[model samples]
Target: MPLYKEIVCNENAKLYLWKITEEIEFFKHAVLLKDVSQKRVDAMKSESHQKGFLAVRMLLQHVGYTDFDLYYDAFGKPHLSDGKCISISHSHTFSAIAISDQPIGLDVEQVKEKVLKIASRFMDVSHLENLSDAEKMKKATVIWGIKESIFKIKNETGISFPKHIFEEEFNLESKKTIAQLQFNAKTENFNVVFDSVEEYIYVCAFEVDPNFLQ
Candidate 1:
């Protein structure tokens, strides 16, 4: 399939999602990969990973971009050669990328019971209280995606999820919330929006103006 969904996050940002239903060879023959990306794709032992990588390229092409227009930093953060902020993520059968004029982060995680089991490792389990097992799993996955999106925005070293990123209380129905990054004796706030895509939770975070949160 082509673009599974397109989300206009704000005046300056957009998110594109791809559903990976085609065979690996299909993507291998479809998108053009730069030397680095080609080598990286060729070296990947997992077909799933390769498909996800190529699907990302297909997404860039969907948005009038090519692999040549993208690059990565020493920290492995992706950047557009034209100066747009970009974030990429893929899980199992889906892949997604977000482009923005503002600093942004995005994540998509498949809803799975395993997130509930390890909730304590990355989030406050108290937030799960009163929820049924299924809700707990869904909420935990959203929280994980929140932290991951923030981490991608920061892309800085030593930022731990449980210790540094904190999500404010939010209900699943709200589909939006606030978060804070407390690290290095400084604090930053982010605006968060998320939704369910098929069985996955898709989350996007943007660095917010301090006054905007008030």
Candidate 2:
């Protein structure tokens, strides 16, 4: 029940962060998960869910949702009976969820070197050309998060990066960034917000109503 922080992104959207100590029982009862995986169960054994159910349950709580009565679509996209659009992402000991009245996507990634090696696959040559040594790593990770968020929203995987998706760079000092996604025969776009946590980076993208798609 301990909320670490909350960010008011807009009148319609808000983000929250929670720190779970010995409150594992909170999730156990909240989700009604009888036989969660050992990894998840073990996370309860500790103060966190290391790739476990804690993340999901915490997310549910953040959105003021209590019903464990939920199911996943064919692509593993979580669906609620009320039809609220939601997306989730988790890393090591932390997890994040984004819920919105409109279609939204979210991703949390541990900043690591592996993202650098795969940058070329997801980032266009033009993007690579504009990066300096230090900027490249951060830029690549942001791109990965952007694509991941898009994939979650689309409910499909294996989408080619850089090739199929594109992002318009924003000054890190700015309040928002823009990401544009193009699939086989369709194109959509969103306004994204980026945040830098301790060792991880989080990105959220949602459609700009009346002018854009999510």
The best candidate in terms of lDDT: 1
* CA lDDT, candidate 1, residue 85: 94
lDDT of 2 by residue, 144-214 (tens): 88888877777655577667778886555564677777876778877777777776777887885544323
Task: Give Cα-based local distance difference scores for all models.
Answer: 0.93, 0.66
Q: What's model 1's overall lDDT?
A: 0.93
Off by over 4 Å in 2: 19-31, 34-51, 67-69, 125-134, 209-214
Residues forming the 10-long window of minimal summed lDDT in candidate 2:
31-40
Error of 2 at 92 (Å): 1.3
Clashing residue pairs, backbone N/CA/C < 3 A, model 2: none
Query: Which candidate should be chosen as best, given TM-score against the real structure?
Result: 1
List TM-scores for all candidates, in order: 0.97, 0.78
Tens digit per residue, CA lDDT, model 1, 113-166: 889778999999999999998889889999999999999999888999999999
